[model samples]
Target: MVDVATLEKRPPSTIALLEEMERAYKDLPMEAIVKQDILRQGIHFLPEAFQVIGEYKSKDYFIFSFDHIPLADLKDGADTKAPEEIKIQGGYFDLLKTVISTRNNPHSPYKMKSVEGIPTLFLGDISIGQAEYPPIPSWYKHKTKNGKFPGEIAPVIEWGYLLYLTVFRNCQYFGKDEECAYCDINHNYRQQKGAGRPYTGVKDVEDILEVLSWVDQEDQVAKVYTITGGSVLTSLKKKNEVDFYLQYPEAIEKAFPKRWMGKLVAQAFEKEDCRKFKDAGIEIYHPNYEVWDKQLFEKICPGKASWIGWDTWIRRVVDSAEVFGPDKVIPNFVGGVELSEPWGFKTVKEAIDSTKQGLDFFMNKGIVPRFTAWCPEPYTTLGQQAGPPLVYFCELLRAWKETFEKYNLPTPPGYGEPGPGKAVFSVSAFMDVIGYSGRN
Candidate 1:
């Protein structure tokens, strides 16, 4: 019999795994299947492929490191050379344009190579698709009056459909006891500083406004702006979490006045507190509940459990629906985290069942839940571990799609178009699987 370590070291063939999952989940688009695999495992860039760095929007360390390996471990300056995201199309799969966020994992079977002088994505020796990097926004050329790069202050993600502003780089939730087990916000900040990147700890409102002024004047592709960062537990700059976070949208809407779809990702708040964001012109709210399992919530999110308690968190999420309206009050869970090691469910069935329950609870009330495919980045409390199988993500996507349609819900605002190929929401296939009518 093969030893567990040997079995763990050798995964089933990549193409074979895709084929098996395709047959098992035929309703899910092939585009989404491939996207989820890349998101979970990350991609390694060849030296030749790294040549495209300056020509495109490179990874900005926008929030978390979002890499399988830390910056210290990545060779050949991949930390700075990797593209913010890649769009895959035309290969063995004849895939449509699918945008996927970049996560560097040198060991991932998927590799970015310059195949015959063309940028390409490969699984083992098989070419998956022609890879296209996002173009640099013209405004990225300009610096804030204080000498800040636009990408550092305000970066565009989702193929330039969303402006990602991480105002507070460091979370007040310090140490393993307080940080989310799978998160690396605090660690990513340290690695960035260690690497001598000019990452800001806390961005001033004026600096953010200055960046947006350039964005507003020069860009038209950005349809939404998401004001988000690490959770503010006690206080940031002497302001409470609400006051600290609320200031961004409040200032943006005050300055721009509904120029872009305004969104916020923060802790779940009471009905009245939720109104503060709504009143400030935030059209969409994302109170990300990282996982659905109750026990996992206690173990994985001890800080939140200790500070707010899961019961209160859930209640706050539900109550916020009144303020933002059910459809606009979207919540995000970290996909595949329900199956994380040591504390997670023993089987996918248990994980799916638990997550599906949460979906039903929310979707039944017109609140559509969303998720980002979990990347097990290093140095977090969970450390580096094998993420859930591709099948788990496929199942989660299906559950999300079916529940979404069951309610005949509108596409959650802020995220660009839903459905395979057209989806720019690179983090998870939840958006890609939307409106899919089974594979041909």
Candidate 2:
């Protein structure tokens, strides 16, 4: 949150940009357009507004920093003070209850400030909505025998609707030549350590079980738990990539079968490797095809391109659908990565057309893809520059929604409910744009 006394004035053109985008993209919800802009640009929270989230759940740095600026650049003590996500309800544009992932940017024109101790979201001077912070879950009070709180071991996102367990904090993709250009996993892990926070690089298996035990007993809102982390290229405690991540689900399912829907977000493994996860009782598989464009995929994700090669990686994605079932094999693609510079499509139409070809290829076979709106976190390589325009995201959503309907696909499972207000997967408005009513 910012120190209001030292807040600097920013250009008012951003508000005008938002209005222009809204007017142009009338088919898409105003909520979707505004949320995309806020995510792309990031937000600066005034101290007065930060006070409104008293004792609420703060960010756990799940995998990436997801901030516009690096942790060192944040002057406002927003590193640990800002709420995990903000839910804003009807105000300036009569916006529905939209849940947005918090990304701190001190210079953003969109600021969160308090008006009479009630959290109010603003675009310049205009009110957008009243912001609501997510309350701390009941399980947060309990601790494991090793003296670790459940919140650190397994943090929940989407307003406490899903449990996120990033078991391997750091990726084996070590440097600029290896790691994905847009990813900040290694850097964020180092920064968290520098900050003196209790960020574990490799969480213990028993610790995960102990924490989830509390979640099992105390939590009811959590319907899904995702077991994920940075890729394991070499070894994690003498276990290969598949063996290392397998322990969590194998143990969880053994203890409580079908307790909560289990999802795995990992590297694109071959059919045989993927079946081990399915056999271990994992319900959904997300082998995220980071981007659809082949040439950009090579330049941006060097390690993945080198190790598996783009063709092999895509085949594995389709092969995984056979083992996990097409509907359950949900491969994720970074929505805006294809539009990144130095090695991306120059036009929005070109970007959409290239991505849609991939989408259609998957959807035709029944494998569905979902995306998280890209955050131009200034720390990462591609993120050093700005992301795609608001128009790109708007059209992306429209294409995604229309294609989903065209294929007559079922809603992707695990993320709570579809449509705005009801949807809790806040990282992107993919869920928000789907089945949106005027209310949400």
Candidate 3:
């Protein structure tokens, strides 16, 4: 068995691990490796660090809890105080600016502590990096007519480059057997409600519109908006999955008529069903394939495997390319899940080879697949097991970048400018690996 005790040690340092990855994958950016390691290992903060992060757009518990620990386990109230994301720069490695989504893991080797009244990340007393929290957007200071917070209706991520609207909070993929084994969406909803936060279950259309109006009028940074929610196997508010999610984009477009780039994250639909979303004014489509290997896909995402099967899902993703055009149909895979315990690959090489096949399959057809580095939240089934090694993620990013350039694909739309130091998509480094000219 792999030793958890050894992995959790603060000696050897985060910088050392990053240097090892840098040596192995020299072509991949040092920024992407550190970003992936911070994601895989997570980060800790001193109490004073929270006070320093005071009102700078704290985490909204958007979609999933995205925490390494459960809501019930946070005795120090770090959940409420943690910043939405942190930008790392200037340390032993002389790193470029790298943005990483926050995932709370108290035992991580990387910890955020205050030094001379400023927040910094340390590895065994060595200051590996300096950190900066995203500035609170102007719209966050405004409240809706019914007294709803802007955070509840719309939350900005990627340094306010995208507005995230999780229209229906909960997924119908209920219970341990039915829901994706790696998912914490249902549990996150319950925790947010239990914590007495004003998290709306099924957000009203007008409420979303009201928040968008504020963003459109006052915010200059936001360039895209994604309308998404949990999987709806049956119906939500008496509407099918497609119809329910389609309404948000439809209403937004009708009201504003293409004011910003629009995207949708939903279950895979037939070509005809996808056309309705296109007709409704959605410019980009993300039908996340979760995992690439068939057995792992079945075991990890049981609902998707049972409902749609891998072959049908891939076909629909390709079919939708005809409707939305190849560049606009970007499917996502959860990057490191192929190495999860109980059913995943036994080694990093096998895992990367398997995922590389999926990348070639998609990109060969002019469709590009994106990924988010997996975080094992405490409530999900997979969270009961440990996540993959940092090596797996480093190798995966290298492989993904190789395939993407092999196809000579353009930068996928909706996401802001790409390449190291310029990418704002925090969850994954795929954006960080693309070539950019800084012309956003």
Best by lDDT: 1
Q: Model 1 off-target regions past 4 Å? A: 1-13
Per-model TM-score versus the true fold: 0.96, 0.95, 0.95
Report lDDT (Cα) of residue 101, candidate 3.
95
Estimate, for each residue in 1-440, the C-alpha lDDT of model 1 and write its tens digit.
21222323326448877777777788888999899999988998988897653488889989998999989888976877899999999776789999999999999889999976778999988888999999999999998999999998998999999999999988877887888899999899999999898999999899999999999999999999998988887778999999999999999999999899999998889988899999999989998888987789988998888889889999999999988999998999999888888899877778899999999999999999899889998899888888887777777888888898898999988888888889999898888888889965
lDDT of 3 by residue, 1-440 (tens): 32323433323335666666667677777778788888877788768777673468789888998888887676455778888899988787777888889888787788888887778988767876788888898888889898888889999999889889999899888887779988888999999899888999999999889999998899899999998989898888899898888888889999989898999999889999999999999999998998889988889888888889988998899999999999999999998888887888877778899999999999999899999888888888887556777777767887888899899998999989888888999998899978632221
User: How many backbone clashes are present in model 3?
Assistant: 0
Against the reference, the lDDT scores of all candidates come to: 0.88, 0.84, 0.84
lDDT of 2 by residue, 198-218 (tens): 888899989988888888898
Error of 3 at 274 (Å): 0.9
On the 0 to 100 scale, the lDDT of residue 32 in model 1 is 93
Steric overlap count per candidate: 0, 0, 0
Q: Between the candidate structures 1 and 3, which one is better when assessed by TM-score?
A: 1
Q: Rank the candidates by TM-score, best first.
A: 1, 3, 2
Cα error, candidate 1, residue 42 (Å): 0.9
